[model samples]
Target chain A: MSLTYGAIGWNRQKKIYDLVLACGIVLYLSLFIGLGAWLNPGATVETLLIRGFGTCALLLLHIVLIIGPLCRIDARFLPLLYNRRHLGVTTFIMGLAHAGLAIFQFHALGDLNPFVSLLVSNTRFFSLPDFPFQQLGFGALVILFLMASTSHDFWLANLSAPVWKRLHMSVYAAYALLIAHVTLGVLQAETNPLLAAALGAGLASVISLHLVSGSREVRADSHSSLSSFDGAGEFVDVCSVDEIAEKRARIVTLAGERVAVFKYDGKISVLSNVCQHQNGPLGEGRIVDGCVTCPWHGFQYLPDSGASPPPFIERVPTFRVKVDGGRVLVNPRPLPPGTRVEPARIDANASG
Target chain B: MITFAKWKLAIFGIYLVIGAVFAVVFLAIGIARVDPAAKGSPIGFRLLIFPGVVALWPYLLSRWIGGEHAPRTERNSHRDGSGGADQ
Candidate 1:
């Protein structure tokens, strides 16, 4: 959350995250290459490096894909979501290294251009036994390159979040392509049942986690619709005031919108749950120093105004809220971003 | 065999040629005109976005020519309902 965009808004936490990431990459590559060399005495150094980086990138991609659903399931996983972009970029770099080595080893020695050789060398598209699996890997790499290049806030700001998000969502396509790449390329030759089982387990885990989190969200929406309506459906009875803890928020679905109703300092303020940065869930965050701090990146917004503090210009939409009979009834219609509304006062004596 | 490869190479070549030109022009003159925050940004910042600009030159060029000088607020379900947008 900077007024002026830099290459990277590095802080203590980001530095620590990158340092740990570097150490992990070094450790994993060292172990993989060492074990590969010990196991296969005939394998060359290039072969070991290609396999090591390829597997590392695939593992990182799995972790990246799982982080969102993990955070959705539990708030404690928010720290993993914080530096997830760094992990994504690193994954692309590792993939590039693997692709670079593979291309050099296989195609660079030919008379033709290496890329042309790569594309034309294998024309067995119809045959499963001899399919051109490198094409799938290449397609995935192109998608990853786009994502990694545009991972900065500059692209996010320019592309307007929704478009940026949609573009990044093509990661699922990349993941699919990579899965096919591995299945056709390596699994064809390897007689190892363990590798096949591990891939199946990873695929199952990704699918199950997404399904679980998505169903939970659908249930929340359904619960909101089934609950009581007030004031001719203008206001929805979201929850009781006591249901929201002090400095914390109770998120409710209202008219197809997720609204965060926060209780703080004997007052209640309702805001759109979407964070300005990365569309993180603001309802999952707690108020810090009188401002709603986003759990993902610590982007802060005033509970009343939905605006970030001075010198920072990020803002979310506020909602019209009222308290009746210890229950919080909120107008589903949102106000403009940064619009200030009087916080609904909470009576201490009222039984919620 | 070589024909399909040549076709792919031609497409790639054209995109890179245009992208190279667009990258130079955008970084030198067009970026600051489109984004105020990028007006006096450092070389590192320019270098950082270079790849993205090259890949998305057509879209960025449209925005630049269409006079969208400011960063657009994102439209969402809640914001659309309110006839507003979010940052």
Candidate 2:
């Protein structure tokens, strides 16, 4: 909510969040190294550092990826999403450490530039098991570096939320690259089936979580579309007024656009489901302080005009609505953004 | 050993030059565009984020120059407005 960013707007909550994160990382690393040393006395310090940091970064990436779908499934996970950029930046740093040690230990002694050696050392791209896995890891690291560098509100505001979001979505590509890098690199060298099975399990869990969340959203959308329109011209029967929980909304697709009809304060207001900032789902969010709050980042809009409150300028398209025979009906034609349409008042005498 | 050292030095030199160029650009844009509310941030905070600014200067510059001016009315009047559920 800052107009000018001097640095990060770290509050008490953020301070606590970061403190816990730092302590967790330290604990994880110490335990990992200690256990590895006890289990394999022959393992060198360089090997331990490489494996520990690499595994830690991979684990963090999985956590970061799951946070999105997890939040969609349950609102309790939103706290993790709030400070996800910090986790991403820490993951990048751990990955950088792993790359640094691996290059220094394996490629630095050769009579070639370590950077060049990383690119050309194993030019067996034609061979499945013998491919240059380091190059894939390097590519994924570059993407992570880009994401971490731009993980600030300054970039989000300047880049426009949509473009910023698209840029960050490149993490999925990076995740895929890293999976390949590990499968071809570490898994090939390590003869242990346990490590390979764990990696496979992690990948499957991530994929399954995404699939389940996606199916839930599809079901919601399909349910909205299943309601048949009244024979009345132009106006469609979305749902009964009672079907929408108070302060929440019933989202329906009309004229190829998703519109959220919110029931609040004994009145119903229809607005475009897409939020003006970051395109968050407005239907999923409840009304707070008489404004429709976006669940993603808490961007708010006046339900009637679909306009953000003063000092912040954002608006969403509004739709005309009418209530007849206890059924809420909406005109498919959307009004221009910021247009003030009268809300359809719910009748007190209507039966539930 | 000598050849390896030479290659390492050459790579280091190239990186230094690139870093210097980006640092200057970052300082210019970062000072101009940082949020006014962030004025309370300490000098140490600014220094901490300086490296990130340098790495992402190209993106910052593009966004600063190309601001989002199209109001919702102009864009969403006729267009189908659909926001992503996961975002």
C-alpha TM-score for every candidate? 0.96, 0.83
> What TM-score does chain A of each model score against the native chain A?
0.96, 0.90
For model 1, how does the per-residue alpha-carbon lDDT over A1-352 read when each residue is reduced to its tens digit?
8887788878899999999999999999999999999989899999999999999999999999999999888878888889899999999999999999999999999898999999999999999989999999999999999999999888988988888999999999999999999999999989989889989999999999999999988887777562477968778788888799999999887656788899999999999998978878899999999999999989999999999999889888998988988988888778888989899888843564
The prediction achieving the highest lDDT against the true structure is 1
TM-score result, candidate 1: 0.96
**Residue ranges of candidate 2 with Cα displaced over 4 Å:** A11-16, A109-111, A226-232, A348-352, B1-23, B29-87
Candidate 1 per-residue lDDT, tens place, B1-87, comes to: 788888989998999889989998998899888888788888898898899899999998998899898888777777787777544
lDDT of 2 by residue, A246-347 (tens): 999988877665789999998999998887656667887889999999887777989998878886666777888878778888887777676778999888
Model 2 DockQ (Cα-based): 0.20
Model 2 pairs in collision: A4-B35, A4-B36, A5-B34, A5-B35, A6-B38
Worst 10 residues of 2 chain A by lDDT: A1-10
DockQ for all models, in order? 0.64, 0.20
